[model samples]
Every structure is written in C-alpha cells, then in structure tokens.
Target: MDEYFERRKRMVERLKDELKISEKVAKAMLEVPRHLFVPPHMRREAYNDYPLPIGYGQTISAPHMVAIMCDLLDLKEGERVLEVGTGSGYHAAVVSRIVGEEGLVVTVERIPELAETAKKIYESLCYDNIKVVVGDGSVGYEELAPYDKIYVTASAPKIPVKLLAQLKNGGRMVIPVGDFVQHLYVVDKDEYGRVKKRSWGAVRFVPLIGEEGFED
Candidate 1:
C-alpha cells in the first residue's frame, strides 16, 4: 500500500518535470491507484512513462500521454466526459478523480471482457460516477450526447463526426488521428458549431475499430 503511494508520487513528479502538465491533471494522477489497473505482474512497472499491454491487444496509454490528453481536454468539475476507449480503466480512473463526484464519465469499450474487467475495478475503487459500457467507441455513445469533453484513446484514420456531433458547444476533444502512424489533434467546437483543430504531436495507439474507424 505504501509502495503504491510512493509510485503515485513519482508518477506525479514525472508528469510535472517531463511534460507541461496542468495541476489538475497532476492531482488526478496522484489520486488514482494505477497499480490496481495493471495486471499483478506489471504492478511494479505501472509508474513507468510507457504504455503497457493489459490484454486482448489493448494497452493502457503512457502516464504522460494520459496527462497531456487530460490537460488538453480541460476537464471541469460537473462536466460530462466521454472516453472512447476504456483500456484497463486506468485513464478513466484518473479522469474520474479529477471530475469529482459531480462530474460523470461515460467510457465505451468494444471488448466485452475488458469492459467487464474495468467495471469491476471501478466498483472496487468506488468510482460510482463513471459508467462503463460495451460498444464500438469509434461511433461514440449517442445516448449520452453533448459531452463537455471527449477523448478518443485509440488512433483513427480521421475524426469521427459522430463524436464531434456529441461534443457540446464550446467543448473540446483530444484524439489521435492517422493510420499506420497517428498525430494527436485537439479539436474545439464553438457555439456556432465552428471547429478549430490543432495537432499536438505524433502519437501511436491501437487502431480504433468500428464503423467510423478502421475495419475490424
């Protein structure tokens, strides 16, 4: 237990020194127990700044990557957030902590097994504010439309309009777009539905598989 706390502290420092991370993101990183999300064998390496495979070819994104994405999303308490992928539920857990009890996080996972596993982890952590669903995340979850922030965890060939449509006015979305390679794009939607897009940098993620993404 104390070891996990130490690892969390180390991770927070890594985010601050290595990346231009926001304070809220750093706080979230420190609060969530990342070791619980990774497999037992990988717990010792959970704090490392690198992506680790969970299972089913999916991976929890690097800690710094998660921080950057969270910072770019600009999450606020009471905001409605949507996560396109729930790999190991680690990213969602971090978001859950930042959003507080008022905010709600709806994460979609295409793999049923992974979704179930994530749900158990969420329950164990008492993250009642986050809802885990099994579906094609590339299509986005329409039932919970007009999200204040949207994060696509996987790499897509293009930004799925369905997700953009789901973003609230003046909302922001951070997604990695590309095929063999990917670049993180920060998209903002204005009140008039005008979208402003900018690329953060190159990134590599598992392919987002679904109707709006790569062919499964």
Candidate 2:
C-alpha cells in the first residue's frame, strides 16, 4: 500500500510537470487507484507511465495521454461528457470525478467484455455518474446528445460526423486521427453548427472500428 501511494504520488508530480494540468486534476489522479482498473496480472505496472494491454486487443492508455486528453476536454462541474471508449474505465472514472455527481458521463465501447469489465470497475469505485454502453462508439451516443465534451480514445481515419453532431454548440471534443501516426485533434462545434479543428500533437492509438471508422 505504501508503495502504491508512492508510485501514485510520482504519477501526480509527473502529470503536473509534463502535462501542466492543474493541481486539482492531479489530486484526482492521485486519489484514483489505477491498479484496480487493470487486470490482476498487470497490476504491478499500473503506476507506470506506459500503456498496457488489457485484453480484447485494447490498451489502457498511458497516464500522460489520459491527463492530456482530460486537460483538453476542459471539463466543468456538472457538465455532461461523452467518452468513446471506456477501456479499463480509468479515463471515465477520472472524468466522472472531475464533472461531479450532478454531471453525467456516457462511455461507449464496442466490445461487450471490455464494457462489462469497465462497468464493474466503475461500480466498485462508486462512480455512479458514469454510464457504460456496449456498442459502436464511432457513431456516438445520440440518446444523450448535446454533450458538453466528448473524448475518443481510439484513432479514427477521419472525424466522425455523428460524433460532431452530438456535441453541444461550443462544446469540445478530443480525438486521435490516423492509422500508423495518429495526431490528437481538438474539435469545437459552434452554435451555428460550424466546426473548428486544431492539432495538439502526435499519438498512436488502436483504430476505431465502426460505421464512421474502418470498414473491416
């Protein structure tokens, strides 16, 4: 337990230095036990800064990526957020805490097994505000439309129109685009339905497979 706390503390410090995120966000990162989100066999490396495979050909994103994406989301208390991939539920859990209970988070995952595992972890962590759905995440969850923020964990060949349509005017979305070399993009939707895009940096992520993504 002491070692876990120490490693978590280091992760917080790294997030502060590397990502330049606020201490409040760092506090949330420190408080959340990432080990609980990974498979038992891989728990030892939970605090490491690298992504780890979590079955289903998916990976729990690196802590730096998580922080960067969350920072990009620019979440506010009581804001409704949508997450494209739940993975191990770590990112969704972080978002859940940042948005608070009054806020809502709907996370979609294509794989049923991963979604089910993430749901169990979210429940165990008492993250009641996060809702997990097993489906094609690239299409976005329209039932909970007008989300204040949207985050896609997987890489897409192009921005999904469905996801852009789901964002509330003035809302922001962080997504990675490309196959071999992915770039993190910030997409903002204006009230007039105009969309603006900006690139943050380079990243590599698993391909997003769905209606708006890869054919196979």
**RMSD for each model, in Å, please?**
0.9, 1.1
lDDT of 2 by residue, 41-125 (tens): 9888999999999998999999988988888888889999999988889998888888989999999999999999989888887
Each prediction's Cα lDDT score?
0.92, 0.91
TM-score of 2: 0.96
User: Any runs in candidate 2 off by more than 4 Å, and if so which?
Assistant: none
Candidate 2, residue 107: lDDT: 97
Tens-digit lDDT string for candidate 1 (1-216): 598899889889977988869989998899888989889999999999899999999998999899989998989999999999998999999998889999999999999999999999899889999999999998899998889999999998899999999999999999999997789999999999999999999999999999899998
- Cα-based TM-score, every candidate: 0.98, 0.96
RMSD of 1: 0.9
